[model samples]
Target chain A: MADAPETFEEFRKSFSYGERSDLDFKFMKSLSDDEAAQFLAGLLAHVGDAYDHARLTDIIDYVIDWQARAYAPAPDAKRTWVYEEGPFATPAKPLADSRVALLTSSGHFVHDDDPEPFGVVGMTQQEAEERISEFLKVPPELSRVPVSFAPGELRVRHGGYDVTSAALDHNVAFPLDHLHDLQADGVIGELHDEAFSFMGAAAQMRLQKETAPEWAKMLRDAEVDVVLLVPV
Target chain B: MCHVSVGHVGRAIEEAGIATTAVYVRAFGHVVDEMKLPRVLITNHPMGRPLGPVGDRQRQRAVVASALSLIDSATEPTVVDDLGPFRPVGG
Candidate 1:
């Protein structure tokens, strides 16, 4: 424990894969340089000196599994079909002059709006699961969050991943404030007056078939030149 | 939270004549490629913090700026841009 590796290079040497796949090693290498630093700092700081190869591998395995489940499509969802003409759209204007909008999948809504995001909140674990199972059978609605809304004026309602980070600062997931900053800097012509959000872990089949066209039409009607999609 | 759903939504938006650039975790690069999304920016940050760490305004701003830039540069469908490692304001 006291001899836990201090660097990723050192850490890499602690394990050997004579007959096993190196999938886990590749996953660890995918961490950005700064993320790697944060990963090591947090591991060394909180894990203290009791780290071992098995323990570290267990952490990696858990993360891999969690992410796999989080991003997998709902069972009821079938493969998505792309637009025949293709989905590429050239910006009609430069970013610095284009009206940019943000559309997030963070399941956020204005405090007073009281949107029901799959109605999973406050229910027991079993109840929530049942609610989500039924909810995923269709496309969910979207909430329009004002770009200038205050902190306490917003609320989050999502089932995937812990919402604490976004709860502390909605910008972590939505980034509306930063978009506003970019607009102020003239990096973008304008921040669309409203940003949109919705629960993302739902039926993609229904989303593409029904809800998505409506979202597209609305943004198109607003003359939005470019949209940034942020998925929680 | 759901990169696949986001990709589908982005596709719909693009089909409606609105340019779209989606931010996705690098871990899901395979899905983005498989789906052939119009435009995408890859970030190595964790799932919940797609832009960056909480309250780290500098990094978040960088991510947003990059996404906007991608809108201007991408000339074809399925264009993916790697934001590379995040370098803080003055790390």
Candidate 2:
């Protein structure tokens, strides 16, 4: 484990790094800022003795269950909770000699390429959140961006998390800039001419069954040897 | 959900014969296990900033480097390297 956090501020930062779910978001929404602080304080009190990964996991599990029981209108159940099996592939060649491509779920689109990509372009944040489930039912739209695409022309639209940081610097989610830099430094052999983006906080059935296979074929046709997936 | 969706996408791409490594915020590794992605590098950054905080190129490069290491070294299904919480300097 990393060094145990010392103060509440430190604890908060540490906790933020942990994984979160819809339940956690709703549970947090239910808590006032003061209550949230108190909860953090309660957790902070146990930092040293019983704060290992397993124990923290147990606590989180307990809180999730408690939230389900305690809240009047429980957090909306995730409609698509299916976990289908997936296939794997081993690298045919070393990274130093293989062509690489990037695929991200950061909801980025070219500025003028698609005016209303994902159908949530002009909607307010409130509207997008209200209808995100509906949006997920649509087939995943792959936004094919050339590696040479200008970073200044990228625009982000995603309802699952705060887009402020991504809007400011897409490298937070896309990382194409760094990938290009790595390519220039010969960390990898070559960057594929195209990078891919799509909204990932979706039901995923269509993505898995229909769209993803198409994406795979495209990458294969392009002779990409490796793909780096960055999920926001 | 992003982790799960991205895992699915990675799976399809890999199944097509190209190797893949998913870099995602650490949430629901068990689900990733169920999906059986070939390799994953889980970071403790927030959901939106999976690479790291915005504008931190050094930190983002560290994440990509970690992912590359996972890709180069993984020998089985679901190889994971959890690089714990990367705090930006003086944040």
Candidate 3:
């Protein structure tokens, strides 16, 4: 490969489309003056070696994608909602009453609360479990126990803004895997069919558009009626 | 870490005109103040998994219900009351 890409297209098409860390330098050039400056600073700080410039470029590209997603025009028609997992007694039943939920990823959560230190909530294990139990309304015996939770933090300068972001202390717990288990076992009245995991804070518009079609299709496929988002 | 892409996706879906409800676990206070999105649920949970820890179905259901309720209740951007910190049985 040449030391520097001559065109934006050449730079954008250089990396694999899906790798989160790959930097599309061409995309960086296309950024508005503000975005471009942020991209360059992030590149210099994260990409210490010339060889790693491509990776740095990918991160920048991801940021650009975030900008696009953030500013995209709102759609006019009612779109379908999808969930990843939940309880549905009948697979063929209509989802008119069903709701879609969103779960946030640790990284994006941090960005949402930029400048705040990670795990500032200082939630204790007892507090975490109690909150989980209350949120789900599950008996102590049926609830999945959390084993571990940790925080991840990052700092980046973008668009004349300095961002110091940190993920909440992430907790890893056993899966309450079966939706039916809740209802069949008398845990709740209905199973929602699916739940969601969110990392929206990390998403760029370009990438979201590329990925949204699948989620939209999932809602269509499952015939979901409502979407419920729970931010991490 | 909870990736930023997730929020964008939700926004994208919302922009697509779907009646969407976003439950922000930790940044509820910030989202309500900053973005001006509709039907938001606020909690002080971590990222990646929003409905509280992973496998607690009851909490998940409540969170879902809270978010769903927002569909009809949110006339403008609104934030549901906080569920506060998690506590184990009778703690």
Candidate 4:
């Protein structure tokens, strides 16, 4: 077994904020002075050994779960379009039909696009959905959100039994369904027929590029107008 | 879709000349002074998931499109707009 964390603070530090700090900074910028203070207060309140591993995990998980629901898309806000240069560009003319495709990979099934390639892991759609649901349960509001699986080209090998079972399960790290739902509600106006997904983390970009053409083709076949890529 | 820090990815995308909008959930009705982007949306939702609940296809599309539309409609360098709530069905 590994050495126990030196202290509660040490264990907390092990939670690994790394790039997540960047995410937090962005989140802070979006807040008002008072709101920011409240957020910081919440974070401060949970510090120290007041909670154990399971409890801390639950707290962190609850924070993430709360944030997802709190950040769920609003309907009245105006939407904007972003078109990447090179291959993916918004056409000069709007698409006649606004069909969009949703794409995502089973969590833990890391692909080339993932920044941290933990490798592949076998998981059924049902298992992935259940895992995602459990993840959302910490924050009750998110329980209402649904999960959908759209066929796509990205694939990876199962990490196998030696790997921790948790490692093989889909983490659903991002709020993908929320993004897709926004698209379908006419809030996004138009969506490409096919959406794309891969394992979460930093290393998956390579796989994403290689697989992009195939996804593009899928969108083309579906006569999709705008491809909305969601990070899950 | 992809929840990124505004300062980190938002500016990078905008600096690249690609139109970009940052959506702030939970900070709704709150004014942000440091935002330098072309368009931004503020709502009362949480972070990580800018668009509401996962798997709600209809709601996701609407949020994405609304963010995209700001690019064409925004008149100022930094426009701050509010999306009241995530009422996907009737509202």
- Winning model by DockQ: 1
List where candidate 3 sits over 4 angstroms from the true fold.
A1-96, A99-203, B1-4, B46-61, B88-91
Candidate 2's residue-wise lDDT over A1-232, tens digit each?
8977575443333322223323234435444456567665655655543545435543443343333332223246443544455566888988878899999988887877653635545655445555667767776677888889877877777666667788898888888888888888888899998888887777677887888898999999989999999877
**Best prediction by TM-score:** 2
CA-lDDT, candidates in order: 0.70, 0.70, 0.39, 0.37
My TM-score estimates for the predictions, one after another, are 0.73, 0.75, 0.39, 0.39
The complex in candidate 2 yields a DockQ of 0.50
Residue lDDT tens for model 1, A123-223: 33233233555657667778999888987898876655456678888887898888888888899999999999987867878887888888999999998
Candidate 1: residue pairs that collide? A232-B1
Query: What's model 2's lDDT at A229?
Result: 91
- Assess the local accuracy of residue A34 in candidate 1 as a C-alpha lDDT between 0 and 100: 63
Regarding DockQ, does 1 or 2 come out ahead?
1
Model 2 spans > 4 angstroms off: A1-86, A115-127
lDDT, residue A6, candidate 3? 50
Docking category for candidate 4?
incorrect
For every candidate in turn, the CA RMSD to the true structure comes to 9.9, 9.8, 16.9, 12.7
Expressed as tens digits, the lDDT of each residue in B1-91 for candidate 1 is 2677887788888889999988887656656776677777777665676777677887787877877788778788655555454332233
Over A94-212, each residue of candidate 3 has an lDDT whose tens digit, in order, gives 23344333332322222233322223343332333223223222111111111121223321211111111222212221122323343454433344444443222222444445655
TM-score of 2: 0.75
Per-model i-RMS: 4.1, 5.2, 12.2, 10.5
Please list the residue runs of candidate 1 whose C-alpha ends up more than 4 Å from where it truly belongs after superposition.
A1-85, A117-130, B78-91
